[model samples]
Target chain A: MPHDTAAHDTAARDTAARDTALPGAVAPGTAAGPAPVPAAADDGEQSLARLEAGLDALESAAVSDRRPWWRIVLSRLLPPAVALAAIVLVWDVLVWAHVRSGEIMLPGPGDVWNSLVAEWGPSRIGAAVWDSVYRAAIGFTASVLIGTVLGLLIARIAPLRAAVQPLLSGLQNLPSVAWVPIGIIWFGVSPATIYTVVLLGAVPSIAVGLIDGLDRVPPIYLRVGRNLGARGLDSVRFVLIPAALPGYVSGMKQGWAFAWRSLMAAELIAISPQLGPGVGQVMKFAQENLDLPLALGSIIIILIIGIGINQLFFAPLERRLLRTRGLSRS
Target chain B: MTLTIDEAAQARTLTETAVRLTGVTKRFGKQTGTPVLDGIDLAVAPGEFVCLLGASGCGKSTLLNLIAGLDPVSSGSIEVSGGRAALMFQESALFPWLTAAGNIELALRLRGVDKARRRTEAERLLRLVRLEGAAKKRAHELSGGMRQRVALARALAQQAAVLLMDEPFAALDAITRDVLHGELTALWQETGVTVLFVTHNVREAVRLGQRVVMLSSRPGRVAREWRVDIPQPRRIEDADVAELAREITDELHREITRHGRVGVDKGASGHAS
Candidate 1:
């Protein structure tokens, strides 16, 4: 039976090949027009493979090339370092030239550096930084969870989207610091007050970011997903989420900024013993004591933490996402 | 020579049809609106290559969408003997986040292909599309032709009995398009999957399809049909292919001119009033 089937298959293949070779021999509209056999013999297959490989190699050479790690690091670090040095030099020159008003004294860069190292111990500075970072982390994480769910709901449900879209945009535009007064009244100078302020500030922007991302996803991807047997949730998981990722990541970055700023504002205004000493509390203490160098040092620390977190975390993340998708040049 | 419309052929019943659409009509907005596809009755036999040719806005794509089950038909039924029809679009529509192999594997994974088997199966499909080395390349990294080939591989990974393609090669350069046409024909022959390819290009229809069906615009209906008797390895410049393409283009021109004159007459009367 095996031998007979093999012979029959060969005969069928030959007839198909003959039909292709001599097309007019078989009339059109014949449903039984023989199925064309795989015409690629071993030789033909090898040649085709060779041709395709050459084409791929030639074309892929134009694809984005990776710079060496050291080069990338140097490029990223050099310009910012130069700018910082230039600003410091200008500040030092002004102080040397005695450019000052009567009451407010602009501390020299060295004075600020000394305050950073000598006045506050390394452990104290670390603690202050840690406290603020911890609050920001918690607030941002909560905002991400809430924002993602809210965004997905609004994106999927038409009525919910229509109702909430305007309100969401309005909240995003409202300054998060404006919530500080309401939060203090509601929670009374506690961590709850700070967290409430942070949430209100960050959630709107994160949710809006996600909505915009979901909105920007091309209609074609959804059609392709449905056609490939992906039902409702499956479509969301496989197609919608990945396509919206770039936008979502950018949203998370903006949310972190808002969360950090809101936390600082709350800490400066609604301080309590239970809240502990964040960078904002330290800055407020320096202001009360009228210590110019300590105040300058605290401000610098705030700037460093903000820049450091974004540089260390979000920048790399956004870069990686864009690189993988070929959406970025470098 | 004027191509004959094989009316009997259109009505003929095939015992094993991959796709059967009977009186399929689709209207976009209101119930009273003229249908995008007016009573489209098409039956594609297993392993048959059918090209649906028409002018722009003739609803060739709408017909494919209806058959592929991406959109609902207003009045008629579509039955596919296969599990589901896989579709390919003009833009490739590949997920940018995924590599070529990942894209194909996603399709396989969706169809419930086992984890261990998916890798090998994806590799096999890539080879079938002559893209063995492009497994790791993302959609944007590959050339246009390569991306389309990857899209084709991903579609085939569905293991669908019928494949619906809507102007899949319309964006490529002429040389790339020609090369892809040969590859597509070869792939069709090897896989023996039923293809319902929609295109506005007449020569493309004659080059690839076993039968060409023309759709009339302004509520698209099957206006004419022609069986292409050209052999495999037929060129776009071949005498027989050109002859058939000229006849189809002439019919298409007439259809357009007729519509044009009616619009002009309406404008003239409206202006006078």
Candidate 2:
């Protein structure tokens, strides 16, 4: 018993001296030292080995099995539906509580629905939607062409990047609504005014998006491309552009939002008989007439259209790009 | 006398040499640090597999880049007889956005192959790498070994006389690496492309190469060379390979130790002790 006690004491002293000699070596338990150190290292190695094995197994399994189709559909569909239902329920409760009595002040869901059915006919609504969509399409298309070229120039040319990069960032943050008055003053409440507003609002983000994407591309890719004899325009077209696609696509999505918002702002502010009524103009007309249900219905329509276009067009493109690049988790 | 004899032999084989470098020196900047490669002279014969073995900070990769024309040599002349050389990195360097076929196709297209031939040629190369089924698979979808094989296929698509590889299979698992070594040897035999492979692993160099050249780091220079006349299909764990690796590793250790002493980095040696 005496010998055992002496050996234990010696071990304790040795541990303490070691701990003092090398600080922070023993992490959690300073009291239990040398004995635990080897054990911890062994444990760490085992875990690392296990983790490596697991990853290998996962990589092999990943080759055969794909993300299930049903899971994709459910993920896309279920949450949005539930959220929409909850919103409708809350809106109904507010209306029942008489928060603001009368259709002019706050319209109930049924009232909005009735007003949409009665006042806004299919043909009239279609024309309004067409007007807004056509204007947005033209503006967004122009923005994309100009923005892409400008972005490529800025990304490649150092002096241009230095000069324009800060201005683009500033413009991206500036609300498109602020451009409506200037646009009207310049174009005098014509279709040109709306186009000008959309261009001003959307171009900055698209150009910036391309620049950001190009900047993030690894230098190794360019080196590899050059080694393969892809020089100048070919390198830019094949290597830089494809590598920068994800960022560019995201920037385009943001640009679309800016374009859509600017078009609406322009339409609302610069309502003209010659310009024809758009969804935004419909809302303006509703507001002037104090028809809250019509206004709410028009807003609902606008929201649905925006969400629909994104889900149908931009989302798929973005998802496909990310999937091919192996950037997506699923 | 030995250097003259070696040069005489090299001169006799000059007509068949796929790649030749004379007095190659690479400096990063004007006077910031010592030159990475100092007076490097290397000659690669047609269809020969040469492994460049070195420790960390060796200019092995830099040497490959110079041969591949990815970077210009600071002072020497490099002659690659076969058009531009194709290079494969430690990483697959495959475009993640491209499918295996697409990746190969791009190389073919860049090499001036017509549109009609790209698909068939890409398929042929994929079959060469024994990855026929994976031609349509995206880089992310394939296993690491498969990706490397695809990368190899893409290199093959270049149809260059020489292939420059920078530790291409170092990232793979032991089993995968072994499998790739076999595939590479077989492909090398079939394709008959001159290969200048760079690696730090002694056994891997001995196993894969007809000749192993060791480079010492810190102003990288050729320290030693061994002609491994070992027969084909040599295993990484073979007795002969292990024996050669042990000898080379000892030499490598000596070189490292010499460098350590010369550098006089007291803190580094102290930590080791």
Candidate 3:
């Protein structure tokens, strides 16, 4: 402890000395004579002192700081696991007390679990899940392409932006299910109808996100970009897009949610036999048969998939982008 | 006519001038706006280091921007000798997305340097700023001084004969700013790039510039010029630099008082309250 105190004293003394000497320390030979050689020598000495200080900063930062890996993992995983356990406990108690209805009416956690594991096989439920996921993926990919183009156009062209920006916002507020009626009238109960609904749900969110992102790009960045000889497309590609990426990624995440919700709504309402029973369709079928456990099982699957895609893809992508800019915690 | 003769003379003088601004006037808008720079004419010679010293709102940065082609002169011409000059701002201005070396390489890339040579050239520039080891560090990770050093290196990579700096070291702490001054002086000697540095710090201007030009605000105009004959590698605290800075500070105060229309202190002398 004495040694530690002594070391701390020395470090404090060095800092105090550096603070006073930094600007006040005149070139060594200037006292005896106003010689340029001595002045240059003095600069060399000051530079060496600064370099040593910088190296010390870097070294200390590296040595004294480290977060344990296990602690980080525990912090990330513990909360969600506890939440799931609590939900299950509450469900079991409700069913045991016969809170609402019989097993046919409100299924217990065990009944739902049984229906998930015992009744639905990979042959039926797996394909249904895949069908829903595939539909969402295709629709989202198309929205990303088309919406990005639309957003960029809206951002750059003032007249078009004025014409379409309010409309885009209006479209985003309109429920995706509302689009199903129009879609059915236009395309019937086909894949195309599902796509139309998904696009209707997703495209405005993505496009509006992009337009907001582009607007939020700092004007200083654009000025520096142009000054560095980045002209026209080069400026947008290098300066504008990278600066706007955080907003863009969030927009994409929102768009994905919209696409998934719209696809589920479309599958439930349209009921296309050609397109294979999706997760939504399975839930609807279960409801028609009064199979509460199966319906609850399908709902759980949908929720899991939604959470999985975000945790696996969008969250990581957003974190990496923000971390590079030092906008997020490591 | 007289205009043609003036143009011929201007063309003749263009060879030696790294930057030439002839009667440059800048107004932000056509409606009820005072001109920022009013008929300003300045010519910087090749390889010379000049500091533009003025108070805040003096349009020093506006002038630098005009010279760098970032903004157009309202009714006059600005010739950079080269196509465009490189400019550095007080805020390090390095792209946060790029690492130290990546920032430098970007400038080189825009200047059409071959892809294979950009890395080595960027390394050399980083070495010149004594930041070679920080090549992989992002702008936020480095210290304030280090970020400015990288920005300087990026400006150097532009390969322009003229460099415009708008208070590029004003944000640093005293120690870091002093260290950067030394480094900048050394770099200027080694590279021989013509530097037009803008700052309000009188001691800094005396310590760094071969020629110091003072500007007055409220529609900025060049007020006075001084040739600094003090020897190179001058410290900010040096006796001669302090003396010159005191003189400039007095003149700057007078310039400020001239703009105060309401507080008409006719007999206050050098001490304006």
Error of 2 at B36 (Å): 0.7
Candidate 3: list runs displaced more than 4 Å.
Answer: A1-64, A68-71, A101-104, B1-15, B31-33, B262-273
Across B1-273, the per-residue lDDT of candidate 1 in tens digits comes to: 122345444434333688898998999878576778899888888888999999987999988888888888899889886557999999999999899999999999999999999999998787667676678988988888899999999999999989999999999988778778877876786677889999999999999998999999978999999988777656788999999999999998988776787677875645543
lDDT of 2: 0.83
Error of 1 at B50 (Å): 0.3
Candidate 3's docking class is: acceptable
Positional deviation of residue B186's Cα in model 3 after best superposition, in angstroms: 0.9
- Residue ranges of candidate 2 with Cα displaced over 4 Å: A1-59, A66-71, A101-104, A122-124, B1-14, B265-273
lDDT of 2 at A216: 93
Clashing pairs in 3: none
Off by over 4 Å in 1: A1-58, B1-15, B31-33, B265-273
| Weakest 10 consecutive residues of candidate 3 chain A by summed lDDT | A26-35
lDDT of 1 at A205: 83
- Give one clash count per candidate, in the order shown: 0, 0, 0
lDDT of 2 by residue, A292-330 (tens): 998999999889878888899999999999988889976
TM-score of chain A of 1: 0.83
lDDT measured at residue B138 in model 3 versus the true structure, 0 to 100: 85
